[model samples]
Each structure stands twice: as C-alpha cells, then as structure tokens.
Target: MSASIPQDVFSAEWLALREELDARSRSHRLTGLAVDWLDKRSAGAPYGIVDLGCGSGSNLGFLASRLPGPQRWRLVDHDAQLLVHARRRGALLRDRAGSRVALETHCRSLSPMDRELLADADLVVASALFDLMSRSWVESLVAACAGHGQALLLTLSVDGDWAFLDRHGARVEESEDIAVRTLFQTHQHRDKGLGPALGGEGPAVLASILLAAGFWVESDATPWHLTAGDATQRGLAEALVTGWHDAAIEETPTQAARLGAWRDRRLADIDAGELGVTVGHRDLFAWPAERG
Candidate 1:
C-alpha cells in the first residue's frame, strides 16, 4: 500500500467557485433516492446526518432545504479553517419546514473512521470527496453504513471525461489536449491521504462495492455542462485547466512545453467566449439493502 498525502488543502476560493456547479449538476434521481429513504423512515424525532470531509458545508447548504427538518448535522473535515467556515454556515441551515438546524463540527482525518462516529447518523453525505479516496476507504464507509444501517449519498465523483467544444457546438480536435487529460488521469491515482485515490474510477467502483455490501445503490450522471454565459462555470473551467496543466507538467516534466501550449489554446478559447466544457461526474445514493 502507498503512504497517504500529507495535509490536503483546498483554497476557499476554489471551493466557492466550483460549489454552484456542484449544486447545479448533482443528479435529481440520486436526490430523490435519498428523499424517499427519508420519507419512508419513521419520523419520531429529528434526523441526524454525518458529512464526511465536509468542505465549507456546501453539502449542508444544498441539502438542508430538501431533507426533513429538525435535523442535526455533524460536519467532519481535517482542515480547521474549513471547519470554522462550515460551523458558521451550518448554523444557518433550515429545512423546507423553516425549522432551524443544529450543527456540530469535527476536525479529524478520514482514517480509522469508526462506528462511533456514525452510530447515531441516519445518513452519511459527502460532496466532491469520493474521487480522492482509496477503494478500501470507500469499502470501509460502505461497511460502516451497513453495520449501522445508515443511508449514504456521495456526490460529484469524477468520471474522467472532459469535452471541449467550439462555438458551433462541435468537439474540438486537439491532440495535445487529449495527451494532457490522459496524463492528468494518471496523476489522479496518486495518494491523497486515503491511500491510492480512486479518482475517475470512484463512482463505478463504489457502486459495485455498495452492491456487494448489500446496499441498494442508485447512480446518475452529474456532469457540469459549462458554457460562456455562466461566469462561475467559466472561472471554474479556467481554474480546472490551470490545475490540470500544472498536474500534467508535474506528472510529465518533459512534456511541459506541450501542456503549456495546450493550456494557452484552452485559455484563449475561453477568453473569446467560444469554449464549452463538459466535465463528467456521478452522484450516488445507497441505502441498506435489507431495510429492516
């Protein structure tokens, strides 16, 4: 097994830029799965949720209004700074019934995520996190949810497809772009704290794992379809291009010049408002297969 990456840090700006698209792109089918689970459950008391690797509480912001109210959430993350912001944002969550939410924060790493952490949670939710996790980590999560009879929703796991389109809605033919994407996919498997990150394979791998663990898994494509009119999407696309460029260069230093040229062309197209980007992702919802 490979050693984990130390201290994964995501800038606040990066989180803010991508969150809206995340919210927009999340699959309604998966949301419906979770909602149906909530509705079927006995509503004798407030529902409890645990959000693993909750970055800035975007999951809460997107889900609070949809889930049953009188909810209590435990938002967990390794970053103290993000926890601070999540705490502030979590306190403001309200369900559709206009009831105030109770929120708590835990600053801890994902390793050794024990049953105690999830003992009282009705659901486990995480956004944009599964791709950075190892297969074992996801299996562990599935096992934990099964053992405790909890439901789970994991959103925005990358599916490793990126399509760039010209103004006429046709795919652009760029060999350099394809090369960079291939290299970036290779880079995605590098250790990112959870051991050998699954990257683009997350959704499929996790669905299989959940099914084997005896959970009813529901999945849908949650791709971000970005065009020139969406400023946030454009900013996110630019950031994504820059990050991929850097990662590709780091992965293949000798090809830095080629990746640089590819980056320039992508950015130029963005500037001309002629670029369309589609990033593939998947949203997944799983519940206990037994449903006792």
Candidate 2:
C-alpha cells in the first residue's frame, strides 16, 4: 500500500471485499437522479466525470452502465497499484447506450484541492471517500463544482452510526461496546492524509455545503446490513470488529485490554452466528439549483 492511501482501506483486498456490498447499499433513487441530471446536459459530446479516490474503479463499474452513454471518466487515486486495477476494470465498462467508455487514471494525492482537475468535468463522483476528508476540503470541492456548474454524486459516506444486532434484528449493546465505539469514532477524526477527517459527519457536512452553494441536493440512507449467516458478510463483520478494536486501542491505549476483550466477544458472536452488523452510510446527488 502507498503511504498516501488512507487507513490502508484502498488496498485491492479491502476494495474487493466491500465492492459488492457498496453496490447493493447505494441508493438507487439518488443514482437515478444523477443519471437524469447528467442526461439533461448538452448531448453533442460525451459527459465528463471525475471519480475521486477511485479505488479499483468500483464507482465507475457501478455507475457506468447506469448513466448515459459516450462517457469519459478520470479515475484519481494516490496508489499507483490500485490505479492499475481501476484502469483494467474500467476498460471493460460500457454506458447505458452500450458504447465503450473513455477512461484515464491519475495517481496523485487529492489534498491542496486541484481546481484544474474539475475544469473539464461535467460531474464529480466519489464513493466511500468523503469521511476521510476534512470540512475545508469538502467545501473547496463543492465550490469548484459549483463554479463549473457540475453535478455531484457521492455515495457510502459513513454517517457515524453502527451496531451489533441479534439474528432477530434487535440491538445488542454492552458498556464496553459503547466505549469502544466512542473511541473508534474519535479515531476516525484523526488525520488520514487529509487533515482532520470528518468521519461519520462527512455526509451531513457535505450536504449542508452543497445546499449552501445553491445546489439542489437529494440524499438517502445507504447503510450496510450484514448477516452472520452469509459467509462473505460474516468475514466483513469480523474485519469490522478487528478494525474497530484496533482503532479504539490506537485512540485510547489505556483501554487496550478492555477493547481486546470486547473484540474477542464480537468475534465469538460472529462465529456462533448470533450477531450481525449494520453500518450507516448516506448517498447524495446534487446539481445546480437552476437545473432543478
């Protein structure tokens, strides 16, 4: 993994693990609006889209066939290896009209807010990325998009809500779980190569900024509800438990023993097929108010 990749979450393993879940969890309604917004643009040329943090091109894979045809995509990420995966997968994408999509990749950091990157884009799209960005970065991005009259679609931004649930769909809470959660949330705000990350607050903050910028924004819940009975989701649940435990320990080393116990219990529950995990996320689609 490149040093610039935040939290090591952009690795091919992690991207592959979450890709299907992300596709299933994203709000189709919001995506439909984005497609409609893009369709309304002048039809003489292909639509230009830029996917920030384009991990393995999962965003492109999900949105390509859903959006209108003759599309050009610029996949941006700091990890060159991931960019290679993105480009390979992106080459196989076709738009709604069954036309081959134009694709390019840029391996660079997103900090410092590159205005020129958005200069030619008709739409700016990102998935599972905003939570790692500070408020200022988001504000800068929205301002640039607004200046260019570009549409924006962002998906799977963590809303800072999650829970371990019983097979009956009831919440399973413990005191240590709450403590661990608080610590993990705090850890989320730590600088992830993007100054202070917004973490779960990212979606709401971005929505507010878009609204303030005279954009008509539509948003919906896109939470991941994973079951222990399914093998893949069970694995993801285990990973979440391990990740949360590690993050909580990083935030409060004094509680390492307690958090470790909590992690063990969570893994045990998963192994016994007694619990599931629900991670909250939100998807937003915004366009210039004039278009509304």
Candidate 3:
C-alpha cells in the first residue's frame, strides 16, 4: 500500500477536491454535539485544540471557522511539506464571528507522542484519520483523552459502503466494481505507520474503545453524496475513481485488465455527467461520561 501510494497523497489539488464534499458530508448533528461539548468544556475561556494527522490544515481552516471565540491549535502530522501548507492556511483562517486564532505546527507522528501533547487541549480531533489507525493506537488515543478530560471529534472515516448511481438513479451493478472495492478495502487495512489499520470498521471500533474507556460517544453517518453537475463534485468523483482503480489494481494484479475496463467506464460516466457516487463515512464525538 505504501509503495503504491503517491508521494503527495494529500496534495493541494486532492485536498481541494474533497474539502467542500467533506464540509457537506460531515454530520452536522454530530458537530452540534461537539460544539455543545466544546462550549461546556471551554466555559467562556480560550479553547485549545490538538489536531492529529492534520494534513494540509483543511480541518484547521474548517473547524476554526465554525468553532467560536479565541482558539489555539496545534496541528500535528508527519509530513513536513503538509505541515508547512497547514501552517500557512491555518494563519489565514477567518470566521464569521471574527474569532481570533493562534496556530502551531508539529512535524511528528501522533502515535509516539506523550499524553502531554493533549494535556492542555480542550479538544482533540482528526479528519479522515482514524481509519488509518490500529486498535492499539486508537486505544492509546482514547486513554489519553479520557485521562486528560479532553473532548474528542473524529470525522470522515470510510465504512466499506460505496455505490454508484446511474442516470435512472438505479445502483450501478458491475462485478468488477465489487471485486475492486473489496480489494481496495483490503489494502486500506494494511499498516499505515500505525499498525494494521481498522479500514471500514473504524467508527465502530473507535466507539467501542471510547465507550469501554468510560467516555460517552456519539456518531453519525457522513456519506459523500457526489453529483457530476458541480465542478468540484466532478473533480472529486474523477479523483476518487482513479484512486480506487489504482489501489484495486495494485492489490489484485490478476484483475488489472478487468479493473482497468471498469475504471474506463466510470471515467466515461463522469465525463458524460451521469455518475452519482456515494462513499460512506462516519463522524464521531466523545466526552467523558461524567463531565465535571
């Protein structure tokens, strides 16, 4: 999986393609719960956030705008290049409330960090990240937050449910599509610097881990509902299809020819503006069961 990945998997183009989709797809219901928790936890004081696997700071820009008041964020990621982009974008974040914000970048992996990394944070969050983690990594994260009395928000985790809709709104049923998707999900579960990833099972696994650690967890489905009419959605759809095709072929070389044909068909659908794609994801928020 690592060898086949692009050096800039989280590039600016890719990030832009999915940002609005992520904004629209994220569960506002779960976000409301997170805001309530943030409100209560911050209690009119400054809010500090620690963003794990922060990527190019799209999460920082998105959350900073919605979350209220003065805020401080520590964006952590292993990619120095992404951290630079994140820092630059994070500095430009503006909110409707004209909220003030301070930003810092940490070029390090979250797994090996001490609990102190989250110690003074009011919230610990990550976007499109939990699915890349192992059970032990998530457990450590849950323990750190629970131990430190911090609220958690994790979003945009894939759940192994995806479908393509035709012009008639009927589900696109191609055998190669199913086979490729299965293979891609299998690749998703391989180690991604954290141990064997949880892949599509991420949300459920995280909920279970946090709940067992004595935290109250709330979750909501946040599927990317893509339509080819919009340019941004079209870009996202194209990129997603390309990514899935590449990963699928990489994982199952025997099926490359069949998957290539399937890829060509999906690309044609996108170009013809008749493709509708739904990629399943879940958003989660957790706080100590008993808040002080």
Best model per lDDT? 2
Error of 1 at 225 (Å): 1.2
Between prediction 2 and prediction 3, which has the larger lDDT?
Answer: 2
Across residues 1-292, which tens digit of lDDT does each residue of candidate 3 receive? 1111222455766666677778888887877777777777635657889998888887887788788657889888888988998888877886437965888888887666468778679889899886678888888888888888888989888887777877665678678778877887887787877788888888899999999999988888888787655555676677778888887877888977888999898888887888788888888988898793
- Model 2 segments beyond 4 Å from truth? 1-7
RMSD (Cα, Å) for all candidates, in order, is 3.1, 2.2, 2.6
How large an RMSD does model 1 have?
A: 3.1
CA lDDT, candidate 3, residue 32: 76
Off by over 4 Å in 1: 1-9, 229-232
How many clashes would you count in candidate 1? Answer: 1
List of clashing residue pairs for candidate 2: none
lDDT values of the candidates? 0.80, 0.86, 0.78
Q: Pick the candidate with the highest TM-score.
A: 2
TM-score, candidate number 1: 0.94
